[model samples]
Target: MSGHPVLTMKDVGVCYFRKRGFLKRQKIWAVRNVSLDVRHGETLGVIGRNGVGKSTMLKVMAGIMNPDAGVITNYGGYSVSLLALQVGFLPYLTGRENVFLSGMLLGMTRTQIAEKMSEIISFSELDDAIDYPVATYSLGLKARLGFSISFHADPDVLLIDEVLGVGDAQFRVKSAAAMRSKIRSNKTVVLVSHNLETIEEMCERVVWIENGTTRAIGTTADVLRAYMSQVKGRAVPDPAD
Candidate 1:
C-alpha cells in the first residue's frame, strides 16, 4: 500500500423513506456517519451482517447515489467501478450491447471496449448467447456477463459487493483468479463480503459496520477478531497461531 488515500468519505450518510400507513413515512438511515479513507494500491475489506448497509455504502462510493448527509472526496479523479450481480444492464439489449454500455459507464471509451469485446465474451463463456437479449438470460448467465465486463473495465478503484460467489464452480474459480490478479497488480479495491476467510486472505485492512455505522476499522486481523468475537460469542484464534 502506498498509504495515499484515493478516496475519502467524511461522515457520509444515506437515508430512505418508506411508506408507513396513510400520509406517514418512516425515515430510515441506511448508512449513518460512515467515515473512512480508501488507500491507493490496497485491498480494504468491509464486513457486516446482512442489512447492515454494506451495499448502500458501496453505491454511494461509486457515485450511483448521493449521500443525504456529509461529503465524499475523490482525490486525483480516480475512476471507480462497482462489481455486483445486478449490473445496470438494459434488459432489452443483447449481452454484447450491454457489455459496451456497462464499459462506457465505467469510463472506458468505445474503442477501448471494442478492443476488449472478444476477451470479455470469451471470459464469460456466453458463446452464441452473447447475441441474445439479456431479458432471456438466467441469473447465472447475467452474472457471468456482468463479471466479465467489470473484470476488463480496469477502473482505478474497484468496489465489489458479494459477487465472488457468482456463476458455477468453474466460473467461480476463474473469477476468483482474476480478482487475485487485480490485487496482485496493486489496484485499489474495496471488498464487501460475508466470507471471512476470503476477506482475511485478501484484505490488509478491514472496516466493520454495525447498525448502519462503522463499528471498528483497523488491520484485518484485529477487526476480524473483534467482529468474530461479537458474532460467535467467543474469542477468535489468532491467525499467527
Candidate 2:
C-alpha cells in the first residue's frame, strides 16, 4: 500500500430521525465515532452483525450521506464508487442504458463508458436481456448489472456493502476473481460482509463493528478470530440457565 491514504474518516457519526408521535421524534444513531482510513491499494473488510451500521458507514464514505458528527478527508481528486444494488439506477431504463448512466455517475466519461461497454455486457452475462428494461430484471440481474458497471468504472476507491454474494454461483466466482484482479492492480476497496471466511480470504485488514461502534481493527486473522470468539461466547448457554 502507498504511504498516503486515499480516504480518511475521523470520528464520524450518522443519525436518523424517525417520527415517534404526533409532535415528537427520536434520533437513532446508526453509526457513532467511527474512524478509519483507506490506504492506496488495500482491501479493508468491515465485518459485523446486521443492523450494526456497516451499510450506513459505506453510504457515508461514498458521500451518498453526510455524517451528523466528525469529518471525512479526501486527499485529492480520488473518485470513489459505491456498489449497491438499485441505488442509482432508473427502473424504466434498459440495462444497457443503466450501464452508461451508472458508469457516468461513477465518474466515467461517455467515451470511457463506450469503450468499456462490450466488456461490461460480457461480464454481466445479461446476454440479450441487457436491452430489456431494468424493472423487468430480477434482483440478482440488477446486482449483476450494477456490479459489472461499477467494477469496470475503475474508480480509485470502491465501497462495497454485502454485495459479493449476489447472483448465481458461477457469477459469484467470476465477481470474486474480478475483485481480486482490481486489488492486484492496486485499487483501494472497502468491503462490508457478514461472511467471515470471505473477509479473511480477501482482506489484508478487518474491522469489527458492534452496536454502531467499531469494536476492533487489526489484521484479518486477528480481528476475525476475536469477532468469532465473541460470537461463539454469546452462543453458549448461560450458566444461570
What lDDT tens digits, residue by residue, belong to model 1 across residues 1-241? 6579999999999999999999999999999999999999999999999999999999999999999999999999999989866467999999999998888888889999999999999999999999999999998999899999988988999999988867999999999999888887899999998999999999999998889988888899899988888888886543333
lDDT of 2 by residue, 60-132 (tens): 8888899999999989878888886655799999998898888888888999999999999999899999999
lDDT of each: 0.91, 0.84
Return the lDDT, model 2, position 105. 82
Candidate 1 at residue 56, lDDT? 96
Best-performing candidate as measured by lDDT: 1
Off by over 4 Å in 2: 234-241
Q: For each candidate in turn, give its C-alpha RMSD to the true structure in angstroms.
A: 3.0, 4.2
